[model samples]
Target: MNDPSPAAWLRPMLAVHRRALAAGCAAVLARTAAGLSLPYLVKVGIDEGVVPGDPDALSWAVLGCAAVIAVQAAAARIETLALARVAQRMLHAVRSRLFAHLQRLSLDFHERERVGGVVARITGDVASMQPLVAEALVNLVTSLVTMAGVAVVLVVLDWRLALAVLAVAPFLAVLVAWFRRRSATAWRRVREASAAASAEARESVAAVAVLQAFRREEVTLGRLAGRYGEERVANRRPIDLASMFFPAVEFGGAAATAIALAVGGHRVIDGALEIGTLAAFLIYLRLLFDPVFQLSELFDSVQSGTAGAARVAGVLAQRPSVQDPPAPVPLPAAGAELRMSGVRFAYPRADGEPGPEALRGVDLVVPAGHTLALVGATGAGKSTIAKLLTRCYDPDAGQITLGGVDLRATSEDELRRAVAYVPQEPFLFAGTVLDNLLLGKPGHDRARAEAALAAIGAEPAFRRLDGGLDTPVGERGEQLAMGERQLLAFARLWIDAPGVLVLDEATGHLDEESEERVQEALRRLRRGRTVVVIAHRLTTVTEADQVAVIDGGRVAQADPPAELLAAGGPFAVLHDRWLRSAAAG
Candidate 1:
């Protein structure tokens, strides 16, 4: 009931290409007119030229038929070209808009939705509209016009034979209406099933490493086969319906033609109708049935296309959960102080149900040029604090300020430039090392990137590679070791030189040597910048100027590491456990 109509989704796209669509429509109409003129020309030639023994009339009629064929061919070519241009332009616009919108959407949206489903909507669903836009829409118009022209000519030639043809019209209409209702639901299932299969395929490919490691290749294959089977069943339903519908339409056409022939033959014998007129009536019936059958076939394509359009429209209708302020405040100069006041937050459940709070009313501050390490068990909101600092998710009931300005009020560009966050798992795109590094600060050349790598002591890893900066990172940086990826992340941070840095266990994946190197790089990078570390390693905690121990979505302790240990609080207990673990190792 809440579903959008096909026109609702298609209207905006059509409006954008209205001029081209209008031209295509004109061409289709011209082509239909030329086609309709041929039967009439045959009638004229038979009555005035062939029977009357006039060679000039017959020659002129033959020439007219030739001209009509030529015009029809030219008009059809122009119509196809014009409609194709409109369809391709619409596809480009829709795809670009969908991709850009996905980027603008909040991380919350991304977290809730499957990446494969989103990709399918962008690629498969959008592409499915091709038939509707390029062919079905235009062809449908042409069929209706041709049918109308044939009907008029049929009646004009012999009213009684036209009556016989009109007799089957109601039955054909009923058949089409029945097919439309059934096919819409069937095609919708097909689209849903296809999307599911696409999502499964993407997930399986992306996690092939895990599958192979667990030796579950057969299991995954079976799962994929099941998904594909569902898709096949969904696809078959509409096709089966169309197969039956087409034959029924053919039967109606045959019945009408038979009636026209038998009735018109009797009339001609009685001298009530001219032989040429009876012949034209039979030709007109064929013309009428041809378009009617074509329309029925086009209906199937339209149904499928509408199903795809509906899915695409649903995605485009979502407004971003996060948006820029109407009037943003200016960031202060020479101030890198970061503070959180009474911050409380919760991540919304994907199913729109209530979920546990990720963070509770908490307060913390770090000086303009100091470090604060957040230490806690997993899910104790350590990473949530870092996320809030980076403005990935705003707090439910608190204000986070950077440089004495509320983060929500600050411009996105300025805020991002001032605050940089590096997560535990660093991601590299499928490109050269230089390309990944340049993403840190746009317009910086290879020299600057090399300098940044050298500054972080990451140059040695790249030097071992054949092409250094030009070496491909492979998909998601799978080519490099985890340590190498983290080092590159540090090099990126150095290039950007932000006023504040938030690292959520940035060295978690590194070995001892890599960890030490990264820590040394961090020490240099922390100078004159507000640093917030979501500490996973004890070494990182010991080096922080202040430690914040979080428990149950709230900060239980906030003090220097030495002071907190002496106090024998939650931080003391955690530090003791960490020390014991290290000594045992």
Candidate 2:
């Protein structure tokens, strides 16, 4: 709930995007200065040309003022274009940093935060910053310049009148400061409410079918309505306050104008001031009001953007829990050999509840080009072992080694190239069939991809498509069945050819026939690669050269499946239950 400091990020926008920043500033400054010339032109026209009854001079001055106005208009257009380019460049940098940081963040972070919230921050939140950079920033400087220029001209016209106008300045300053503080908080609430709504809506839509099937349509609707209602309430309060803001300022500015007229009119009537000079003073007074009016109207946008900027900076400020090593361990020439010695891990639990350990001093090793199957019931540290092997979360106590080198010393890029993991629920991006596959190996050609697809029995499915590799996959691969998605994920994994492969319930969704096909594909992929399979099906683990039974965060048994079955231990009970269940089904 703490807001990020704007200076934490925006200050660096200048250093990083120097050329764009410079161009934006130059354009805005030139335009603002040109705009400042308009009041001076009016003063000249009134005093020197219009007052003299000189028709030719009056015509020439009027035309000159028109020309200045046109130039100011052209400068304003150029400045807008320049500011837009600068804003886009800054947005690109912010998005790039967020993406790169996301890749480096630990799995624990992802588990703790909702996908909808993160997506909203990156897409919706960053987009809110456009007005800040493009309009608010440029106008802030321009308003300052115009205010200063008008004040100087007023003082030159008459010190007493200038001092009178300046009397209301303190009140304006107080109002700006007060509004900025209050409006910033209001805008922050608006953004938070928006993110909350986005997260709830995203979750609801993703589980729409479940909600309908469970007959919870009214419940879901009520929840959504509650969220939207909060958003509406939060939104209206600020708008209501902001609506009163301009009207108040206009009333105050008008009162100041009346006072100026009353005081200045007496000086003119008493022959103490020229008619032309008084006219010039009136024009200068209007010019003074222009900046104040602009400041009043734009405060809401400026404050809102300031709040959004703080949110963006806060997201950027998060330090990735997992980072690359300063000096990376070189890739082993003979491929990967994974070892875990005395590893332990525990998930932080609540104060009143028991803090359960997930992994406890577990030691295991998998030789190069071998398959290790971990068989256990739910919450038996099976998935935790897989996570540790990949260094997704470093063991609290012991060493994880790849090719006899400590994994903590390995560079992230090197580790990623050496290891590939397919989770229980595989995700597919929205793109063509080839696009998802290419993510596995960015530079891989179509021939290589097709070979991988063929290995996984996916080539026939690909051929059945209207455009083969060009066919689009719906969001999260909703277009394909679960088993088909798993097969496609294997095809992708095969193209990468990483030194180590970790499969977490890869065949969970497959029926007997589909499981056989995918098992065959997995077997083909296993050769010459280190494979770690977290298995639920007894039949699959029975095929591994070695199987380890995990119980209570420790390895209960480690041997070949046949040997473990013959011994009649924990694995025997699990295998029995799995077989009985399969028979029943």
Candidate 3:
């Protein structure tokens, strides 16, 4: 889809609430009509009632004026309420769609974007459109209608006075055009500055712990201050322009009113016009210029909204880099068997240059229900292999298969159901223990959840908590210990029970006791499943049926642990170093 302009983006939302929008428009017109009638009513009271000393005419005119005001007030209230409803509903739809699209986008897209910026788009940027969508558009319409009505009434009162009023129109248009050009640019800068400030603040707060650990609080504070300063500087230009706009509009209205009064006063003196008619022309002048002033004021909000809509449209237009095949093949029931043939892959670089290859010519196989452990130094592509097997990224120049079915040809749903990858750092949402557990297998009640936790020997950890299964995990599971979070991850996997498992340094961050507990759980979880472990510690490799040593994006060696240890290859050297370090400790 092409990126929608502000009006185009709002059209669908407006269509959804078209009935309310129509009613609001009707209300605005009714209110404007009532307001326009007041000047003529004043003319009637002065000429036919007060000047003639007719008590009944005077009383009737006063009553008529009062009735018009009452109607105007009622209509104004209806317009306000109706427009507010439409604005809120449109905002709700916009927010929901943006959030859903962000989720559907590929992980590569997210990795390249700032979380703070994305959050700002969903929150502050979306909110900036409220004034424009809910009130400014309606106000613009109402002001134009009021202006037109007053113009017609002025002409009917006396063409000479109407011509005097019309003299200001050209100057008013020029002033408005100038203000719009300046203020639009100013307002766009303001929105950009505001978004930058918001992104900086969000990032700082999210990484407060890191800042504190590195003793860089002052540096972060300085950066935030700089961002806020830019936002303040950008805001000043629009505010100065708006201040000039309103007073300039007022001056034009005064000039036009003065012209009408001077001309009409001479005509009344010459007996060419009635006193009431001249009085009505002065009142109509004010009414005519009122809408012009209001529209000028609304211009700022409209500009901000336009910029926000553009940013939102850019996000919605992004198609995911990784997508499901149009016609996907189904994996067989025995698809747990995993293989990567001549696999080669590289990450994408920001400047469109080729990134260093993370994996190269990697041939490997793991039969169903067996475990293969990959041992390598950091950045040697151990995790990359796990990522490939789980289809996080397709190999650039090779094929991965499960049960002889190419990974790309298989449906995403089937592939995900068949293989599960647990990363080094386990993430938990803000919820209760039971809520996090239920995410793995929805609709399973407490009894089933407890069984999954118990099977991994993690039930006691939860039982020790204040509320057991109902205990709040806090944000990102901060309330729980790191080991506890890891155990919950294992328990989740136990419930999920995928046919294949990819453990990417799952126990790398745990302490000795925690590692022992997790290793016990891993043994139970691995039964009848094809398991691939990215080994960080030498201990994990010892039990694997076959150990593959990765070096410089290639498979350096693959053999049983005993044979590899005796061969004195890369794996032997790594194990010997680990053993020496262990003995020294």
Candidate 1 lDDT by residue in tens digits, 284-387: 88888888777787877778788888888777677666567989887755437889999999887866554789888989989888899999888999888988
lDDT winner, 2 or 3? 3
Worst lDDT window (10 residues) for model 1?
1-10
Who wins the TM-score comparison? 1
TM-scores across all candidates? Answer: 0.95, 0.93, 0.93
* Local accuracy of candidate 2 as per-residue lDDT tens digits, 487-510: 788898878778888889778877
Q: All models: lDDT?
A: 0.86, 0.80, 0.86
* lDDT tens per residue, model 3, 1-585: 233566666788799898999999999999989999999998999999978889899899999999999999999899999999999999999999999999988666787778888888899779988987987868887888988888888878887778866988998899999988898778777877888888899999999999999999999999999999999999899899889888989999899988888888999999999898888878888888878877877788887887777778878888776678889988866436788999999987765455999998999999888889999888999988988888878889999988889989977788888889988888899999889988878888999889998998888878999999999999999999888988898898878778888997767778889888888888888888899999887778887888999999999998888999888889889998989987997
Give the clashing residue pairs of candidate 2, or none: none
Least lDDT summed over 10 consecutive residues: which range in candidate 3?
A: 1-10
